[model samples]
Target: MSKNLSALSFRKGVEKNVFERMVDAADKAGTAEKNDIVHQMGQDHLFGDAITLGAVSFYDFLKKENEGKKVFLCNGSACLCAGTQDKLHHTLESHFKKEEIGHICCLGRCHEGGAFQYQGKNYSGQSDAAVADLVKTGKGDSEDRYAVVSHLQPAILTAEFPGIDAYYEPFKKLIANGDRDALGADLKDSGLRGRGGAGFPLHFKWASCRAASGPVKYIVCNADEGDPGAYIDKYLMEKQPHSVLLGMMVAGWYAGAETGILYIRAEYPDSITIVNEAIEDLRSAGLLGNDILGTGFNFMLKTIKGAGAYICGEETALLASIEGQRPEVRTRPPFPTIEGLFRKPTIVNNVETLANIRAILTLGGKGYAKIGTPQSTGPKLVSLDSWFVKPGIYEVAMGTPLQTIIDLAGGFKTKVKALQIGGPLGGIVPMSHVGKLTMDFESFKYGGFMKGHAGIVSIPESMPMIEYIQHLFQFTADESCGKCFPCRLGSTRGKELIAKARTDSGFKIDRELITDLLDTMEQTSLCALGGGVPLPIKNALQHFGEELKGYFAD
Candidate 1:
């Protein structure tokens, strides 16, 4: 390939502005060498100086010496549990260079034990031999077990997902009109809430960023789904990426912003490639870039892969990550709506939040509003884990009874002691109380649980509650950004106390002391990692107090 073609292909792999600068620097300096170009970027502060040289040198090596296609193996917790990471690493090393095969955090296919991305396609296998075959000849299962059961939902996500145009035709016409307030108002009427655990009104964020005084604005999709059981973002990004891209475009129009970023976790290498391809498709369709839909609304979307930080799932921390800073949560009040993404007004929505925008545009906010209950309107994507017979992503209406939803997954063959609704930080409900719950925002919250990611995980009766609580604290401690003492220290201390109680039979957990610690974390924590970490601990004490008697010293 010619130098221009090579550069163009490389540009397609990254942000447009970044690519333009790299190419410009190369041309102006009269050198196409990788080292010189990287030096220019560092000197110009385009790329951070700390790691630019190593990164650029590696890029140069990949461009010049790499002969085979890139294959990314999933080293996520799920994959690790299945022993895919170690097996696949040794297998790949046998035939391919270490640089040729890379590791991604998760592909969101936790159900599919061993997962890998080869040449932009995702495949899954359960053994080393299977993964090796996947990389060598592309022979692996691509089955993503998912179904949308919402009424006239226009296929939010599915395995046989048609492109965005087939699902939502009127969206193009709506965007051509370029009426920002109308678009924002439509979303407001849709009664859509953010799906990334917060459940905040999506339109409010859009309106705030639109009204914020700033010449430069940004729209970010937080695809950093760090929640333990939540793979809804991964499912959508890999299966129906165009939905997310179109959603971001709709958000850009509503917020009057030209640039958008999809901050996906590096754990999902397949999602990264799929979303980037979706961006290229949008540009090809002339739906992105300057003069979108002939409405003179210029918007461009880029994908930034995260370095597997759970804290980065928080919007403020996500913004910090995008800016090449430590992924730490920022204080609110000067929220992202007011100041974010390089001190500019920014709106950050999760993947599912952005995916809903197209539906709102096509069905009209009121029309879409009729699908679910008044409080939590619109369909929700719930990820059922391996505990269910038919485990996969299921899209259901908000007010569906919890039992009814569970039944759809073929119910449980054995006794389920408790159901962990939402993610790790979400509340735990005893099996007896499950029927009283409804799969909606208000119902979950009323039952001492939040519909965080709507990812339901079942706990078998054999699993002890004490161990579960310990595991939850361990997750929080590891993931907590350590920004606040309450979260960082409290989670660690809680985990240690639980461990001591488990190991040393004489070591008693002081209920009053634990309660005080939980209270402190709930009140003093800077963000959700700390504020919400107390939910499961408190819920366990309230419901499973009897089983936890051994941990409390008499």
Candidate 2:
């Protein structure tokens, strides 16, 4: 009885996996012994499920053996154009296996390409020879890079570090005044929607989490900026780490959370390093940890490095990953604000979203509101691909014309066919419609597009839209978590249909059939990746339908 009991001691009513359950059990029974017990349980069928136990032990062993054992560089569209993947292979081919020498999606360092992540730190701008030399001698130069090309007020992307006081002082003033409620109210008044793809209002998330009843709560900075062309969150984390950390700290105070986490994707090692350093600075300055700012508001900040899963960008999936579970998007009704991160009322804000908090608090909501349009207030960061003459991170007013923003990036170096205003899942707007669009939530939403991470990828007149659509479907299919059928099957089928449409002139893609699949995915999938996969495809069909007439018999 004691032996069996020792093998199973996870908390009741808590959703945890077998490994997590084993880890909790091992707190008393010892790790090695518990592992053995779990393995033996699988053979003995002591637990109700033998297959589950076997699977858990198998994965646990594999996870431990392979942790931090490989390196991957961005194979994303922006990085591919920059030739990062080839350069990575040229550098690390001899040192690592073909499996190890792999490609990743955009590291959000689109402008400063030639990027590769080793262990957990990102290195960029190194030549192939230089990367090889670094592999041999353990010395190389890699750093974060950004540019401010806009004349508008820059709240998030403005890089002038005014010391710790600059970020914390505004919130410190608010805290001292004992107006805890004002923090969220100010955010609401500012109309600062999340800079993440969804563009959900930030204040409402904070207010709900604050109002929720929980003994333990969390404020998570979702720095997992996985969108291919989007690097704003990456830029913010790398260049303005303190601002993001300070924002999380402010969120922590408002949501009544003692613990804050910066969940950064594994691709941006530079971001991870910078954010961790910023947290240490906060701790050293007595800004984090117990009794912050002599105000008795205790807060702790930690950084969790992601395993480069795109689905983990979803808040629920992120929380699941932090809890050592498979990163699958969970159903939401009990949203993250109400029940998240171990069933505690948690608020997850992206790096870009949180970066706005300190500025909002300082500027006052109304002041901040006056920066951009009424619906999409304040400054927004735009990450442009290499096709742009001056491709870099640009901060622009939210409602700025798309043409104006493109002009800021030195216009197109080539004849632009279409533009993906967001990431891959964002709309594919033809050049004809560029004049009609504005770089804001309302405008993009009205145009059946998303202002997703505000990363703009240019589609040259030379690159076929069908090929690009294929790439989108392929990416979605590859990254689908397979937790739901709609996204899982739809993305795969969509990719196959697109591939066929490209190769076989007779292979007519039934538009209605494709629409049904897309609608099913959009209406029923677990998260945005599944639902949002069809947006770009739909947009492509809308603008380029005449061009695609060659593939289908009309």
For each candidate in turn, give its C-alpha RMSD to the true structure in angstroms: 7.3, 5.3
lDDT tens readout by residue for model 2, 155-182: 4557588888666777677656758766
Q: What is the TM-score of each candidate against the true structure?
A: 0.81, 0.86
| Best candidate, TM-score | 2
Residue pairs clashing, model 2? 75-104
lDDT of 1 by residue, 60-103 (tens): 11222323436667654344433456666677778677867765
**Global lDDT of model 2:** 0.74
Q: Which parts of model 2 are misplaced by more than 4 Å? A: 1-71, 80-97, 112-114, 118-128, 131-138, 153-156
Clashing pairs in 1: 105-267, 106-267
State which candidate has the highest lDDT.
2
